[model samples]
Target: MTSAAPTTHIVFPLYPGVTHLDFCGPHQVFARLPGVHLSVASEGGRDIEAEGLVFAGLEDLATITHCNVLCVPGGFGCVEAMERPGFMAAIRRLAGSADYVTSVCTGSLILAAAGLLEGRHAACHWAWRHMLTEFAAIPDEGRVVNDGNIWTGGGVTAGIDFALALVARIAGVGVAQTIQLALEYAPAPPFDSGRPDLAPETVVNGYREKLADVLRDREAAIRRVAAGRANRASQ
Candidate 1:
């Protein structure tokens, strides 16, 4: 008897400047599953960089046929990627077809731009939640948010939790717990600034300073999305 191929497909969309951890953290967990096919997709089939790390052999966006799960990672490049018409269209296609669509940090912004977060409760990097208002999304600002088939995580490292939650949903709680234990997933951050509620004024202000420029760009992207939606409505 021949073995049947697994149907689950995990698609990772790569941009010019993705964060390594944003892709790798959840990727490591998903890759652990047997028979799960993982594909790194880009606007074209080319090499991409993530925080100075180069990833080779990514598929072009046109090559994406279907996916059981889709992951959009965040980084400095996201400012451009989230605004690209083709990129947002590709994400919208995947999110509309995928069994589960999820994102890490500002990756949620990309989904929001694709009009996927409308009326959805989602999570995003605490520093960037204000932008979610533009998408008509209720931002959780939590480590993870599960809104039916869509999942989102806060900041970079939270991708791990996002992936684990998917695992729990797909395989079972035992499988998810096993993977978590194997990864030794226990958290005790030395600093309290990981979340805004716990962050001190100085730390919060510092984070604000770091995000100011990105926030400006994000505002522009949100405006673009709004304009696009308006144009589509007029059509």
Candidate 2:
């Protein structure tokens, strides 16, 4: 008799103001994985509004104790999410037993706040990647960075690439390729301005200017989180 394939439980913890693409892109990829059981949960099992869309019927993250993989998605509410004691505690608990700890975009910041990314290399949005250093995590410019069992994706769309890489690791390159084909994951952007280096100076500067206020706020929040972590460690 043949043995049944073991299930891989993948959990995604959601919060308000989350960027839909950050989780949706990866969710689509992971859903295609064989023997994968995906769960989307929020702090209180309540509905979440993200980028104008409402995600309903979510499981409470506090109720989930274990998972094979934990993928945290990023959004504008990330700084606030990092500050939530319950949210951070749940993250630490889930990551403690997860076979793989991962994040998309600014979600890496949450992992760092949870004390999971220290001494590891991670990827985040180009605008905020430098903040990872504050948490003792080396920020990488790669679209997807894998350091040990920690996987992080750069920005929003990169979540798809990150998920595909993780799928390759969990299953096999052939299986990942098959799924890529099934989804027709091909990219041919009309512009060559995806990265800071590739983007025109004016565009980059304009974007930086536009993000200045939020960036300042995020930095302040990260500093507080880092300081608190340092204090806890010292105590």
Candidate 3:
């Protein structure tokens, strides 16, 4: 008789304002993996409201002692999430023992804020990618980036691709391909404006303008966090 394969525990650390797709896309992919145990956790094991959706009954991040993977999802609340002492502490602790440290979109920023992405290449949403520099992280323009055991995906939709890549890494290309086929993961966007480089200048500018206020607030928050981290390091 053959012994069972070791179970892979994958944990997703969530906070309010998270883009549902950021974690849900990957969650769907990982759920199909054989011998995988998945957990969606929050700082307090409380219900989280995101983009008008409510997620309840979450495990507390502090309660999970160990996991094979630690995947953080990005969202509008990421800056606030990074500022939370308990949340950041839990992230640092779990990442310290995780076989893989990963993030989707601005989630990479959270990892950077946790001091996990220093000097590492990471990926994030285009609008906020530059912010990674504040944390000493090099931002990559790739939809998915892998540096050592740290893997990061670009904006929302990229999480699926990132998950597939991770599945391939953890399981095998064959398994990843099987899952993709099963899910019918073929994507064909109706417009060529998914990326700034491909979109019309006016469209890009308009989107940037719309984001200006939020960007300013996020920038301020990140700077404060970065300064705090620097001060702590010097002490």
lDDT of each prediction vs. the true structure? 0.85, 0.95, 0.96
Q: Model 2: residues >4 Å from true position, as ranges?
A: none
- lDDT (Cα, tens digit) per residue for candidate 2, span 148-215: 99999999999999999999999999989998999999999999999999999999999999999999
Q: TM-score for every candidate vs. truth? A: 0.93, 0.98, 0.99
Please report how far candidate 3 places residue 198 from its true position, in Å: 0.6
Best by the lDDT measure: 3
- Return the lDDT, model 3, position 44: 80
Q: After superposition, how far is residue 63 of candidate 3 from its true place, in Å?
A: 0.6
Q: Looking at model 2, which ten-residue stretch has the lowest summed lDDT?
A: 217-226
Higher-ranked by lDDT: 1 or 2:
2
The weakest ten consecutive residues by lDDT in model 3 span 43-52
Query: How many clashes (backbone atoms < 3 Å, residues ≥3 apart in a chain or on different chains) does model 2 have?
Result: 0
lDDT per residue (tens digit) for residues 1-235 in model 1: 9889665789999898888898799998888765788998898877897776889878998679789999999887786887677887889888888999899988988888778888999888777777887778889867889998889989999999999988888888888888889889898888867777778988889988987887887688778877777689689
Q: Write the per-residue lDDT of candidate 3 for residues 167-206, one digit (tens) a residue.
A: 9999999999999999999999899999999999999999
lDDT assessment of candidate 2: 0.95
